[model samples]
Target: MKGVEIRLQVQYRARVDESIEACHARFTAGMQQFGPPFGWQDLEPPPAPYIKPASGDMIGVEWFRYPIKGLKLQITAQHRHELSIGTDKDTSDDRLSIEFKTSNKALDYRAILREHFPKLIEAYRGYRAWAVFDYYGGRYTDWNWGPWLGREATNPSYQRLCKEPGVDIDGRNNIFTLEPAVFWDNELCRRALGYGPEEVMRRLQGHALSVQPLLDGVYVVFDDDPALTYERFLEINKQFKELLGIA
Candidate 1:
């Protein structure tokens, strides 16, 4: 089992009204405040020599890895950062994800998450509107796409195994969108909100909703209207904690 790397990725999605430029600026300002002691120093866009797109809804951004410190263990956590811009149907989608990759066997994943969850939550103060409290990724992005092709009268997920993107499903009066946890394995380290599209939209009305339940127990909630705000999202997260053992 040599060279088998284990990494933990945590993310959350946010709906923003700002353009890519504005969103990047906000991220840049925060970049100087990540990590311990001081945070990422000498942070800047990719040096001119080897610059290329990092893929998906990225208008512009710089990449850096903040070394996790203060852990009195053999494991090393190199936290990779992504400030991306994307789109959700018409709403601007922004993503921020911190991935911790380690080869150390002494580290406990839950302990690492619990230690950083509060800091991560506090870091996302300014851009909370339509901000989903659960870990999904993004504070921005233009990757506007859905996860389904068509909604039949019945959802096939009730039967059979599904493991791909853009599959047709039952959409009758139901909202079909991409299931959260961009990488299913990535969700293993996340604190799930467990709220389906119907439930999320239903809680904060003024929008049509649909849900495509997955056999994996994860779900995709399609919000016909992205009007949920950060305050409302916070409220929802609080309720999620109360109703479900999300945290």
Candidate 2:
């Protein structure tokens, strides 16, 4: 289904301890303007080992699943001490708030919001948070997009390369270039491949073809592997590459 991605950056002057609660109140109030039976539920905290810091830091995130519209919303508030407080020792705080919304009837939703939540719309205009909501009316598939065994550093560098294209040898703006090309001194490759300098040198000495790291944690094999065999790697890589390319 068609949808719109709405991003709002919000700024607030408040105390660090109160920022979270204040944000919650603002969001709840905004949601209330949308009317009842909207069905809001908090998403589980990012699965364990990936849990974000809960300390008094910048950007407190709250995720919600909107049952009525089947939309996902992320509310993020970032504490800005420098801007809010004149000096480092000062306790005053400011927050950058962001919200994202996606929905099938985007125009209608926007009109409804503008008419019912004028303050929220106004807040969105000057807010400084990194919030965005993407509503899609389509099925989502599960696909792994993380580093694989022996390729820890690969994904990060690939992401960087994708972001800034000069580092790519093929000039394709794609990290896959690094896959066939030798790792050289790229740190991401080292992390993803999970090999130290010495180990990388040793492996390259014997292998004719090596795995190419791609964005979203997939790899490509350009050369044939006889000893360890690249088939398994190629198979898994192809699967993810296809999965990620799908809309």
| lDDT (Cα, tens digit) per residue for candidate 1, span 1-247 | 2212222322224334333444344544654566542233454432211223464332333444444442221111111233233322212223344443233344433333333333333343222212122222121111222457442333233233134333222111112222211121112212223444344334433321322222222222222122334345334434433433332
TM-score for every candidate vs. truth?
0.33, 0.31
Clash count list over all predictions: 32, 33
Q: Write the per-residue lDDT of candidate 2 for residues 103-213, one digit (tens) a residue.
A: 444224433232322333333222112222231101011122344523223334344544662433222122232221122223333433344334433443333333322
For model 2, state the Cα shift of residue 33 in Å.
Answer: 5.7
Model 1's number of clashes is 32
Error of 1 at 153 (Å): 18
Error of 1 at 119 (Å): 2.0
Residue 43 error for model 2, in Å? 14
Please tell me which predicted candidate would have the highest lDDT against the true structure.
2
